[model samples]
Target: MEAQARAILEKHHDNFLEDGNAVPAPARRVVGNFNVDDAKPVARRFRSIRPEHLRKAYDQLEKLFQTELIEYSHSEWASPIVIRMKKNGGDIRTCIDYRIAIQLIKLTHYPLPLIDDLLIGFESVLWVLSLAMAKRLWAVPMTLWAKHISVLICLLRHFQWTKMLLGLKNAPPICQQMLVNCLWSFVRLPASEAAQMDVDGLAFLGIDVGDSAEEDLSTLIEGMTVFGRNVPSSPQLNSVRGERPYICDIGYGTETWEQLCVDLDRRLYRLRYWGTSVSLLKNKFGKKRFSHEIEADRIQAQSKIAEGVIDLPSPSTLRDVQPFLASLNYYDEFIESLPVIAAVLNKLTDEQIRSGRDLGRAMEALRILKRKTVSTPLLRGPDSQKSFVIIIHANPWAACTVLGQESDGVFIPVHITGRVLHDHKFRYHPAENEVVALIRALRVFRAMLAGTKLIKVYNRYSMLKWICTSRSLEGRCRQLAVCFWKFARFSWMTMVWPQSWELRLPPPRDKLDQNDDNIIQVTGRVIQSPPVRLETLGPRCEGWLMSFDGHAKKSDRWGSAGCILWELLSWDVVQARGSHFADVTVNEAEYHGMIEGSKMALVRGISEMVIVGDSRIAIQQARGLIQCLKPRLRMLLSEFEDQRQEFKSIELVPVKRGFNAAANYLASKI
Candidate 1:
């Protein structure tokens, strides 16, 4: 036992405590002051104490009194201490709970410590981040003194990240924020062997820096130096004394971002500094911003191919369609609604575009759509840290989806994919076509889509619902549904419907049907369908923007219809109505109103119209998708069909309920 004791003493010979040795008072006395003149003071009544615990508590009190940690108090202020078991469960600890006294004590603020002043006497100062966990050695009875230390600690933390005040050279802003938010405090100790030997001298007053401090510190330093470089000796930047300027406060200019790019490029050249590259740092910090490396490549590619369609001549023969389509196809990923815009071009092949007026109009529309697409923003590359939104739109003729993301609260396109489903095998119900489009999009962009959280947006509510459900699917649908489940296995996936972005979806990408063969079976089971001869007006085809509204009072058994047309060229709004239509439901009334508007356009020799309404049922019915089961509605649909034939082309689109306020007001007056 004696040898064991000697060995332990030998292990910590420098740390041995000597008998009757008092710790010397600090050279500078720590003073605390509070402006408590306006505060009220109170004294608590002494409560009955437990006899056994009282002995332990009184013993602690006597020790504190003897050590000058506490004194006999005849003042009005009195706070009690409680005896509690220590963590080891072998000893009692006296804890002074100052729950009430702290509140009554008036607040005080300490001026921030000056770093240069703090280091005035030292030749060279080193920052030692001690990883030692702190332990309170003894409990001192509560007094006005201890509160000052608490306030001092708060001041230290408040100014921890203040760079100019802290005298931290070459620290980055991000590192400053991280250090300020850290759960640790700093202390100053004299650099000596004796101080180093004393464990408490190096200890943190509050939370301790854990084992991860080394890694954290290294990361902070790396972040600080990632963009660091030597200052140039410019005469304009130097003082008259030829000394370099000491810029303590940071101010950013437009060139700051460009400098960051240059820094990143230089860092990348070293290869060892790649860990601090923009891409890696974004991954490290989970910042949903573009990576410097990937965006550079994408921008370069865009600039190179931007002029592919610029020199193309007018297409008079089938030979010209391929070159135009190829140029349009090169930028397919930036365009939304590509299938709709290029429907005419998609249907025509080298053998298909015979001399016809429709072909000429289709070619002209293709050129207009292509020009619009080129003007859209460059596609952003996929980001792992950011959540993506895939917008899918499909009509009977084609299907498409666009990948997008919300960055800095603005949604921007990432990639677009779409194709005209000229093949019969790919054709399905419009609802099914929408789902197929989503699945196709997911498959094509799986490299980017994988492991990213995706929000799927669709214009058709039915399609969104069908994709979200797993049951009642069969054959090809079941297969597509399986792929969807796999797609959802990404980091996360969500569904959003009928999105009209305040920042709209990306422009349309024109895709041909023959491009994708992966969806086909080995046995050539896929059949080709004759292109649906959609008698649609070209984009250049002059059309009026028509709006219709219908009103009905079931009790009165009467309905009203109102129509308005804004001429495409003249911008003249022509209004028309057929009110007091007897024995017609509101839905039938809406159909008649649109038909009356079309007839009005026909009378004015307008061959095309893009009709808009707030009624989804009416719009879908007019598009020949929804069946009119009611007798009067079916008769009105027949009459509407007859009027629709009088024009070269017509489109019925649904608007929000309150969108056509003028039309609604006109209908209500009837």
Candidate 2:
């Protein structure tokens, strides 16, 4: 602990040394820049005033300092005027201590002893003020006493003289009102009655209010503007100065007044600084006004309407369509002035352009329609019965058309389309493709509902791509929502593969059997074997199996046999791993194989795990149906039990089929 303390002190000492070394030269440079040499004699002469007058000046300086008119730290020579005046009584030691405390307080990095001492001094003054005000012994007005208290707080806070006015202490209402008035006066802004009421006087100065201070100040300013009369009186008020004084008096001395001016200047400087940065800050912090955004949106909607009208091909020759195409350019310019329409237009390209003559005719038809008309005939064929009609829906975003037929009376539907497009030159550009796809989908869905026997074509890939990229559509699209739910429901499905079948043929022991023909027969037999089999053995068979066990009794006491089989017959198909017949208990061997298999599945990142064991007891134990009796078996059971949770879904099933291929394969290998 001592070493730790030493290390911390050493670090701080180094920092102090670095700071102290840099201070003197800079201080001298600052004093030199001010050219204080000529003023030194005048200051010295004034310093020798009679003690009574000097004390008065000192009191005024103290009040001004408290009000923060002039910063003592920034004054020439390293001492505050309050400390310098104390030397007049020749109390050299006290004066030196006061000067040292002031200097120490001025060092921003140093702890402030002077502030603490000053607070103690202010506490004594507060006692005096309380007694004087309580007794009504002083001739000063209650308002004047409050104003002086306000000046004192302003002085203390402004000069970092927090010691003299600790934030924890509360001042009288008169003092509080006076202080708030003084601060507001420096702000060069009028105060509303509500603001004056809410200022709560000294409460504003107590404690660090953080961001709320700024908010409260802003509220006060806003209230003043909303409720109070404007400054620098209007023309009508110019003739009424005698009746209504321009400036009202709030109690403050000359020193306090000077300090208020200085404080006001500082505040103005800060406000200007903030004003200079407001534009950049607004770009980051202020949202674009909804009115401007909505106007842009409306313009875009109009452009989409115009684009749909102009893009339809003419029924006449291609040459006739040229006029309509030319007219589209003029319409485009007019629509572009509406920012919303311009935004949508900027997303268009040549590939999306349809027939201009059809669009122009559609627009002309819409214009000619009466106020009550729901649909307008746009294009009339030679037969007159055949015509293309534009259908206007109440919704601005929904408008469509029907292509007419003559004999059969069939009308093909045409829907307005828009999309967002991207180009390599400008990646991720917002074009009209998405909106176009949405229009097509809506049209198709509508046709389906209307009992139209039509195969509705849609841009499926684009829709799916949008669904995958945008989270907004994920909640709305049924197909995508179902896919996500399925993925989550069967989490284990992601980690494990379903069962597959593989033939297990033994290696040929004889040279003749090693030939391809004989090998094929063995392989065929292996493939033809039943998937599952249960064998009952006599007691003598157990000893024989132990003799054939290639491992030692204790060492081979626990062993695992595994086989992989594919479920080909059932819809709930799966891959299975299990153990075979052996000297070892089938249950133990099966459990071991399952544990090993689960680890492999985890490594492979399978979302589900399935275990198929021939032993009902083993399966029941795994599912927590039967408890293991032996400690060793219990330990193995515990380890193998929780493999299910590693996957999204897990299931245990018993298979009776000779078709249970995985277990059969394992038994045959044994």
Instruction: Pick the lDDT winner.
Output: 1
What is the Cα-based TM-score of model 1? 0.29
- After TM-score superposition, the amount by which residue 307's alpha carbon in candidate 2 deviates from its true location, in angstroms, is 77
Please report, in order, the local distance difference test score of every candidate based on alpha carbons: 0.48, 0.30
lDDT of 1 at 69: 43
Models 1 onward score TM values of 0.29, 0.17
lDDT of 2 by residue, 89-168 (tens): 54321121121222112122212222223223222111110000111111112122222221211122222221122111
**TM-score for candidate 2:** 0.17
How far off is residue 343 in model 2, in Å? Answer: 72
